[model samples]
Target chain A: MKDALAHTHARIQPYVHNTPVLTSHLLDELAGATLYFKCENFQRMGAFKMRGAVNAIMQLSVEEQQSGVVTHSSGNFAQALALAARSLGVAAYIVMPSNAPRVKKEAVLAYGGQVVECAPTLTAREQAAQQIVEERGATFIHPSNDLNVILGQGTAATELLAVQPALDYIFTPVGGGGLVAGTILAAQYFGRNCRVVAGEPATMNDAYRSWQSGTIEGNDAGDTIADGLKTQLGDINFPIIQQGIDAIILVSEDEIVAAMRLIWERMKIVVEASSAVALAALLKEKTRYAGKRIGIILSGGNVDLSKLPF
Target chain B: MKDALAHTHARIQPYVHNTPVLTSHLLDELAGATLYFKCENFQRMGAFKMRGAVNAIMQLSVEEQQSGVVTHSSGNFAQALALAARSLGVAAYIVMPSNAPRVKKEAVLAYGGQVVECAPTLTAREQAAQQIVEERGATFIHPSNDLNVILGQGTAATELLAVQPALDYIFTPVGGGGLVAGTILAAQYFGRNCRVVAGEPATMNDAYRSWQSGTIEGNDAGDTIADGLKTQLGDINFPIIQQGIDAIILVSEDEIVAAMRLIWERMKIVVEASSAVALAALLKEKTRYAGKRIGIILSGGNVDLSKLPF
Candidate 1:
């Protein structure tokens, strides 16, 4: 999987920015570790999801390109797929939950995506996406679940270790499990002996439960400020994650808020609540990775200041 | 000045992180121009002032180093000087205006500087600093006036252009003009024909007036949320700025606040009001550099979130 991801990196090189890495002295002291932050917040469409979306789009058959691609997401993936489709000169249709952030929908539309609003329920979103695929004959790019997307997203960790080869641990926020699986694959390929840990919100602890049970677990999806982490792990994503991921840690909403503010104040980086989930795990000192070289994936920076969680 | 700054860069390289340059697709679209943001917000003391302070402290003679250094600043320079001195194993005495933000004062103290709280008036701050210099045999490191300090500050622009040579224009928030002068010197050395513009708050338009008159102008201490830019330019800094700087543009307080929020929201980088001054200028759509490659010096990210400007 990691070798495939390294191959995908070459395929997606022209499409994505080699987003710069940043470090902070104050954050280092506070965290009690040397931290190299891979800033994916600077990625096209303002998140790392573009890597996977573009990778998946690029691999489709010429006939598939003619038919266009579709995805169901109200967050980063929707914008990623829309912008990737635009870049590839292909059509993109996105089915978004009606209750999704207005900013997310506007971004997708601004990027030339044909948006279809569905009910907030997952079933409705899936059904709407299916209908769009059936009617338009477009290929659906699952936000997670799919192997191509997961491998594509894992290149972030691959690139990190390429730059800072001595990294000891990689902390990432886990939601649908694609990001974690990708990270794990990269670490294994590099033979870095790097611990792969997931920072998840206590409100949405399906990933944590799934890791413990060795099977996909669905919990009551409670509301969290980290809206991106609300989804449960998929069947395909679950198995790879179970094999590769080392641990899952849960942080409370307040911890996420504090970590977000801490990054804003001390690290001087604007990270979304979902991105802050990893920082929250570090700040909570949930599982000690102190004195190690910690690499944090700052997932995205598309936050609404007008309605900040804190 | 450029040669002197090059010396500073060599001297200070060991202490400071060559802070990463961050780019934003969202910011580019909003400004209708490409932006390369040299993120000094990630510097040692969370600002570019560390570059200047470290160079100045390191260049001190043995006797002066043993005697320590003194300065009066109510902003980022205070913590920068403190941190630089501590890193160099030299003592720092910071005379801060009593009305300075509590967080700023605490940062100075936390960095191992002895803080002397004086009247908020400039005269009182100077008097307190002089008294300390006489009593403690400490050398005064002027915030912007000293040749060594300005030369040290110039290294920031030199480093920036080294990383981004194609910048067509460089925008920097003006306080006492040391940082801008340094940038101008660097641009000249790098064969960059880019205009060097200063971002100043409308309420504190002394720099703007000075640029127009071709002479230093004084303004009554004006209240601005960008507390760092409230001071007038210095004697040594004024001449260099007059000869080299392209223009000084004014940004309204509302624009400053808006830019600050926009940076936090869109760029996912936390910047102080002073740092946002350049962004505010861009938001105002100042002519002469439209559709050009603009490099903005995000001076620092030291805002106290407890009392957010908004």
Candidate 2:
């Protein structure tokens, strides 16, 4: 898996941007750690998921490529898959809940995704995606629960290490776990003694609890502003996470909002709440990582301006 | 004046960021033009005014530098001067209106500017600044009217034209006239047949009227979200803008907010209302420059998230 990181990166290089690494003196001073922010928010569809989305779609056979890809997500991954599949000249069928924001649907549609609206339920979305797969012979790509997607997400960390080779730690927010799993893979194979840590909402800490229990865990409370991290971890990314991830740092809602505000005001970048979790986790234990070079993967910058916490 | 642009840019290079030039496929399609955005919003202190602040402070003699610098501004220039003077190891006295937001004052103080509070009136702010200059032997640096400041602001356009030569037009917002004047200077001196255009609020159209009447004009409407562009042109920059600037495109408040939102949502970057004025101006005349290369300077990204118009 480690050996194939570079190959996967190369395959997606043409379709994804080599997003810039950004830093801020104010954020560093406030957090008490030197932070190198991997700005995946500037990715093609405004998130690092683009890398995984493109990589997964590219790994398909000629017949599979023509059959196209399908995903059951209304988040960043939906837009990422749509754009990625379109870039590869393949059709994408995005199974989105009818209750999803008009903006999200329009974004998926704008990216050439064939939006298949379903009832506002996971079963409905899954059923719609399954129908597409059965009828059109389309391959279903799990947003963050697939090995190929994890491999693709690792490239962001790989690119980060290439620029700033000797980071003390790489931090990412734990959602369905592709980004963290990918980050851990990068740290294990490519980093210079670099460890991988993750941030999770305290209210939705399935990944953290799973790490503590040495097995898969689930949290039913989906009451977090970080709309992306509510989903429980998948079995595929869990074994890899349990093996290599250093720790899962949990942050409060206030902490999350504060960190997001700092990134917005101090760094002057638009980042969604989920993206700020990694920074929140770092700042939570700034004493532990004081003065050390840390790489924080800013997951995405998709936010509703009207609902800003500040 | 044209040749001086490079020297000013080189001098301020150490203090300010060589901000990235960004382009958006979505924005390009919306405007029907090839937009090269010089992201000065990413500059030190989160604005392009940092360039002018550093340049103006750097122009002082050893005696003047030792005596320190003073400015009356509650805007981005206050933070810019504070950081710039501090970077140069000089004391900065920023006389902001007492009624100004505490956040703005704290930003200046955080950047090492000595805050001198005065009544919320132009006369009081100026008097307080003049008193500081007389008593402390401090050199007063106007935010946008100064020649050195204009020269420094032009460096953004210089850097833009360097990376993206053969631009047909460079669009900038006319505030106190430093940015546009500097842009015109860069166009005349360094660009390859490039013409400089400006954007102004329809209500605060003093700069536009000044260009048309062949003399300096004053407008006191001041009814616009572009707080930075409410001021009229200065004597020093007026001549330069009159001679070289191609046109001043006026846009409504709704247009300004729409353009700003587009940059935020599409480009995934935070930009202030004044920065959006340039984009609004370009979009207003999108058909005129259809499919042509146009450079735009996003002046800053220091918007108050709480008061966002969207």
Candidate 3:
């Protein structure tokens, strides 16, 4: 797995940015811990999703590359895959929900992806993407379930650890389980006793429930402000998370909004509510991590301006 | 002047952030120029005003320092001075207009500065500040006109030129002319034929008209969306601007808003409308800078979230 992450990092090196690590004195004072934010929000497609997308498309064989790739995503992955495919000279088919934001759809189109709208449901999206794979003989890439994608996602943590390897804990927002799983792998290989933790929105605490039950669980209501963490874990990455994750911290919607506002106001950086879940989790248990060095993965900066909670 | 600027940089080195220079491929393609944005918005107190505030306060004699510093400002400078003074262990007396945003006032208070409210007019603000200076025996630091302040502000461009010396032009927003004056001096001393340009709001085109007439001028009405650039240039900095500024570009309110939105979406950074004026000017004349390398100073990022134009 470590070797796969290294290979993925090498493959995607030319395509993505080694995004900066930012620190805030105010945030550190508030949390009673020194925090290093791995700013993946400044990543190529404005999200860490770019890392997984690039690696997945680049892993295709020459024959498969000729046929191109396809994915179903209503968030950053849709744009990420389109951009990665376009940059690598491959055609991309994006299966987007019909009710997705107009701005997001336009962004995918601008990146030269062929958008195929489906009914706004997971089953419908998967069926639409499966049809594209069959008709075009293209490869279908899962946003977070594929092994290659998980390896790619792990590279962000790998990079963060490369800079600051002595961190006591690393927190990541868990949605499809790909990022957290990859982060755990990277921390296991690269970090010196660094424990991996997951941050989940209270409204969508499927990952938390799954951690306790030792099985996959679905959310009763995915009505969280942290839109990126609304999805349930998949079987492919669930085992990795179970073996490596130390704990799952659940943060309320109000905490997520407050954390987002803090980053925007204090750091003067634009980050989505989903990214704030990780920081909110740390704030929720500041005493446990006091005087410790921690790393946080700021997932993305894609947000609808009109819908700003503040 | 160069020696003074170098000294100022050293004095304020520990107090301010060496903010990152960000580049957007999409913005470069749109403007037909490679643009490097010197992000002063990420500076202490969320503005480049911190540079001047630190230098101005630090230069005081021990007796003057004991007496403290006083300034009249309703913008980023107020918070910048407050934070700078608090960091340096000096008392700060800030005279703010009552019409200033509640967020700005609260930020000043949070930074431990003593705020004295006055009527919403320049005359009242100055009178209030004057009373404080006289009664408290505090030193008054003009936001833009002070020599130390101008030298401090120049360090931003000095840092920018240190990183990229071959830039063809450097653009800065013009308000009281302090930033543009300092930037022009920095370019003159350090750059390789880099012309300094000023971006002014079209509705408040005092700087543009002043540059044309070779004399100071005042705006008929300061009705621009860029609130920070509404103030007219002062005599102390106006001559410096007249001597060194190569051009002054005027942009409409709509153009400013469009530029601001583009930055927020594409760059994934939270920059106030005032900082967007420089980019709007460059975008307005893309044809003039085709394939050229340009540097722009993003002056500040302190904004009231509730009144966001977008």
Candidate 4:
């Protein structure tokens, strides 16, 4: 896995930026820790999802590449896959939810990808994507279940620790467990004293419960503003997280909103709701992070600004 | 002055972030050039002004430091100076224009500075600041006129070219001419290949005319949404700018607003109106930058979000 991450890093070096890390005295005081924010929001596709997508796309054989790649996403993954495929000169078919933001759709189109929209349900989207894969003879790329994807996602943390070597802990928001699992693996392999912790919204705390019970817990039918975190944990990602993670903490919606507003107002950085969940946990004084050099992976920055008020 | 910039960079290395220079393919395509955006919005105090404030404050002798510092500004410089002074355990007095944004005034107060609001006229603000400095026997730190401030401001460009070594041209919005002159020195001293250019709104073209002729031109009344750039070029900055600056491009007020919207929508980065002046120059397709590796210093990120619709 470490070798795969190293290979991905080298391959994607020319294509993607090593997005900047930012620190704030106000944010540090609020979080009760000296926080280092790894701003993946500034990534090429405006999210860390590109790391996984690039890894998967680059590893494909000539025949597989010619056949094209496809994936279903609420937003970020679709844009990442589309942009990555475009950079590699491969055809991409992105299945997105009909309710996805217009900006996300525009980004995928701007990258020259064919978009297929389905009903908002995950099962409906998957079924639609599967049909497209069969009809077009395209490869269906799972967002998190693939080993290459997980290995590639791990590189963010690896690169972070390389630059900011003094980190004592890492906090990342868990959606489908891909980022958290990859981050944990990277921290375990690269950082000697760093602890890997996952943050999730209480409204969508399946990953938190799954980690606690040693079983895959089903999400209830409640909705969360963190749209990226609504998905179920992948099989490949779950075991890696189970092995490498220190703990998972859940935050309230209000906390998420407060943290999001704080970053926007004070740090002057636009971060989506899921990324805010990690900050929310820390701001709410989640134990194990006090008086330490804590690194937070700001997962994405694809927010509908019209939806947020100052 | 160049030697002072080198010293300032070394002294403030631990306090400030060497912000990244980001390349935008979309922006580059629009401008018909390769654009390197030196993102000082990510700098401490959410602007490049901190570099100057930190440098100016740090260079003060023990006796002078005890008496503290005074500055007059209605924008980023005030907040930056106040914050830098607070961090150094020194007092700061700021005299702001009566019409200054409430948010900016609040920020200075948040940093534990004494703020005195006077008439909106430049003369009135200076008079108020001078009175305070005289009464308290405080060192008056001119935001853009002082040698130390210029040296500190130059560090942005120095750090910029360190990461992105191949720029052929650089564009920065001109206000009091401090940023342009400082960047000019940095580019000349470090990366001699790069031609430093300044961008100013047609409404505030004193620096443009100053670069054209051998003397600084005063504006009777400069009107623009870029309040920070509406000020006349400083005496110390004018001579340096006249020598090193290749050209000064004029952008319209409407163009400035358009550039501001584009930055917010495409980059997902919040920038104040002053920063938009540089982008406006590029979007207008100015001849000097066509097909060139152009570096643009995004001056600040202190927008009043409540007034903006997304």
Candidate 5:
């Protein structure tokens, strides 16, 4: 698993950006911690999803690559996979809900992916993607559940640790749990002393409940601005998270927006509410991490300009 | 003037950030030109005015520095001077109109500046600043007119050139004319063949009119999203600009907002409408510079979140 991340980083190196790590003095003061932000917002396709997508597509056999890859994602992963597949000269079939935003569909199309529309339901999306695997002989790449994707996603924290090895803690937003699981492995392998923490939206606190219950928990309230973290923890990544994650912080809707605004206003970086969840978690427990060195993976910076929270 | 800028860069190096130069391949492809953005929005106080502010204060004699500095600005410069003065252990008395936003005043105060409020008029702001200089024996630093300040602003271009010395053109937003004027000098000295272009709001075409008339001009309408570029060119920088600038482009309010949105959406960077003006100019004339390598001074990234144009 440790070698997998290093190999993944090397494989994805030719494609994705080694996004810059930035620090803001004011943000440090606000959090009461010396913070290093892994700016994955500037990643290819505007998110860290590219890291995983690039590694996933590049790992396929030549025959599988020719058959192409498929995934069901309405968020950053869809664009990430599309761009990654195109760069690898592989056709990508993206299963998106029929109600997905026009812009998102266009983005996938612009990246040369074939968008397969399905009923706006989890089962329907799964079935549609499975149909692509059955009919087109395409490999179905789970956005978070796949081991290769998890290893690739872990490289964000690996890169951060490489840049700031003295980090006392690494914080990530928990969604389908790939990022958090990968970060956990990265911190454990590279950081040695650094602990991994995860942040989840209060409304959709499935990750938080799952951590406490020692089982995957489901939440009905997908009513959060962090659209990226609404998904529940996946089976493959959840066990790793349970073993390695030091803590999980749940932040309110207001906290998420406020933190997002802070990053936008003070740090002068456009980060999605999902990215803000990590900072909001740190800020919520500022006293706990006071004077400590922390690293936060700013997952993505994609936002609809027409719908700013502030 | 070339020696002055080099000296200003060194003197202010300790107090100010040598900000990064960033490039977006997506943005470059959109504009049909390779664009290098000098990210001054990340400078202390979230603007390039920090460069000028630090330079102006550092040039003062020890006795004069102890007496402190006075400036009349309700914008980034107010906070810039405040932070610069506080960094150098000098007092900053900022004269702002009473009608200035409470947030702006609070920012100056947060940076350890004493705000002197007068009536909402240019005459009143000037009078209040003059009063401070008279009563406190403080040195009055004209935000853009001072030679040291203009030289300081030139360092932004100098740093950009140091990173990418083969730039064909440099664009800057023209306001009180300091940045454009300084960029003109930097390009002339450091970039032998690079031409300086200026961008201004079409509604406030004072700089454009001044360029055509060979004399200063003023416009009554300040109805534009680019608040930073509203001020007309001053005498000191205007002469340098007249002698050095190659072209000035006028952009509409829609164009400004659109350019700003492109930066936020594509680049994932928080930049004010003022900073977008330079990109707006290039985009407006994209066909003209199809494959040219251009350097744009992203002037600032201080935007009111509550009052976002998009």
Candidate 6:
């Protein structure tokens, strides 16, 4: 796992930013912990999802590359895959929900992805992507379920751990489990005393429930402002998450917004509500993590300025 | 001038952020120049003013340090002085206009500065600061006119030039002329071919008119969305400005707001309208700077989010 991660880091080094690690005296005082934020929000395509997308596309064979790649996503991953494919000189087919924001669709197109909109449902998205794969003979790359993508996502944690080896905890927001699983793998491979922790919105606490019940659980209604963490854990990444993550912290919608505002106002950095969940989780469990050195993955900075919650 | 700037850089090295240089492919495509942003908005107290404040306070003798320091600013410099003084374990007296934003006043207090509110006029602010100086024997540190403050402000450009010495131009928003004058000195000393340019709001184009007429000019009514760049150049900094600045570009209020939005949305960084003026000026003169490497000073990020123009 360590060797694979190191290889991924080397492969993606040229294509992505190493992204700076930022600290705040005010944030440290608030959380009562020494915090190191890995600013992947400043990543290419403005998200850590770019890391996985690039990795997945890079692993394709010459023939597979010629055939191109496809993915079904309406979020950062959609833009990530498009940008990664564009950088790697491959065709990309994006299957986005019809109800997705026009801004997001335009962003995917701007990144050179051929967008194929479908009914705003999982089944419809999968069907559209399947049709693309069948017609073009392109390989379908799952956003987070693929082994290569998970290995790629782990590189962020690897870089963080490489710099701050003595971190007591590493926090990441749980979505399709790609980031948390990758973080776990990196911590397992490189960390000295670091334990991987997952932060989930209480409104969509599937990951938290899944850990407690020892089974995968989906949210009854994905109604959180943390739009990134709405998806449930997948079979490919769930077992890794279950084994690697020390705990899953759940935070309210208000907590998520408050944390987001704090980062924007105090740190003067634009981070999405999903990215704020990691810091929110740490703030929620301030007593446990007080005075400890911790790392947080700021997942992305892609947010619509018109609809700012603050 | 170079020796003084070097000394100021070393003196304030432990007190302020060296700040990151950020670039955007989209922004580069929009402006013909390759724009490198020296992000002083990310500096301590969220402004480049911190550098000047720290340097000015550090230059004081033990007897003067015991007497403390005072400044009259209703903007970023007030917070900068307060924070710098607190960091150095010295008392700070801030004279703020009575109409200053509650948030700005709170920030000054939070930084351990004693805020004295007076009428909303330059004369009133100076009178209040004078009162503090007379009563407490505090040394008045002019926001941008003092030689020490100007030397301190030059350190940002020094750092930027040290890293990218071959830059063709450096853009800064001009108000009281400290930043532009300091940048000119740094470029003269450190840069190979870099020239310093000033950006000012058309509503308050004192710097631009002053440069054209070979004399200091003051705005009749300081009215601009970029509240920071409304002040006129002073005696101490005006001569330096005349000697050092290559050009001063004037931008409209609408242009300033549009540029500010572009930076907020694309760069995912919270920068005040004053910071945006530098980019607006570059964009306005895109043809001249085509394919050139240019550096822009993002003056500050301390803004009232509730009153955001975007």
User: Residue A161 of candidate 2: its Cα lDDT?
Assistant: 96
Colliding residue pairs in candidate 2 = none
What total of clashing residue pairs does each candidate reach?
Answer: 1, 0, 0, 0, 0, 0
- DockQ values per model: 0.67, 0.79, 0.85, 0.44, 0.94, 0.71
* Model 6 iRMSD vs. native: 1.0
Q: Give candidate 2's root-mean-square deviation (CA, Å).
A: 1.4
DockQ of candidate 2 compared with the true complex: 0.79
- Each model's lDDT comes to 0.86, 0.92, 0.92, 0.84, 0.93, 0.92
For B157-231, candidate 6 gives per-residue lDDT tens digits of: 999988888999999999988898888889999999789988899989898888889888879776999999878
* TM-scores for chain A over all candidates: 0.96, 0.98, 0.98, 0.95, 0.99, 0.99
Tens-place lDDT digits, model 3, residues A50-89: 9998999898998999998999998888999999999999
Clashes of 2: 0
lDDT of 1: 0.86
Q: Lowest summed-lDDT stretch of 10 residues in model 4 chain B?
A: B301-310
Clashing pairs in 4: none
Query: Which parts of model 3 have CA positions greater than 4 angstroms off?
Result: none
Select the stronger candidate by lDDT from 1 and 2. Answer: 2
Off by over 4 Å in 5: none
Better of 4 and 6 by DockQ: 6
TM-score of each: 0.94, 0.98, 0.97, 0.87, 0.99, 0.98
Error of 1 at A242 (Å): 1.9
How high is the DockQ of candidate 5? 0.94
Instruction: Kindly report the TM-score of the first chain in candidate 5.
Output: 0.99
Fraction of true contacts retained by every candidate, in order, equals 0.82, 0.76, 0.82, 0.47, 0.97, 0.59
* lDDT per residue as tens, model 4, A2-109: 676677778877777788888888888777789999988888878899998888888889888998999998578888999999999999998888998787788899
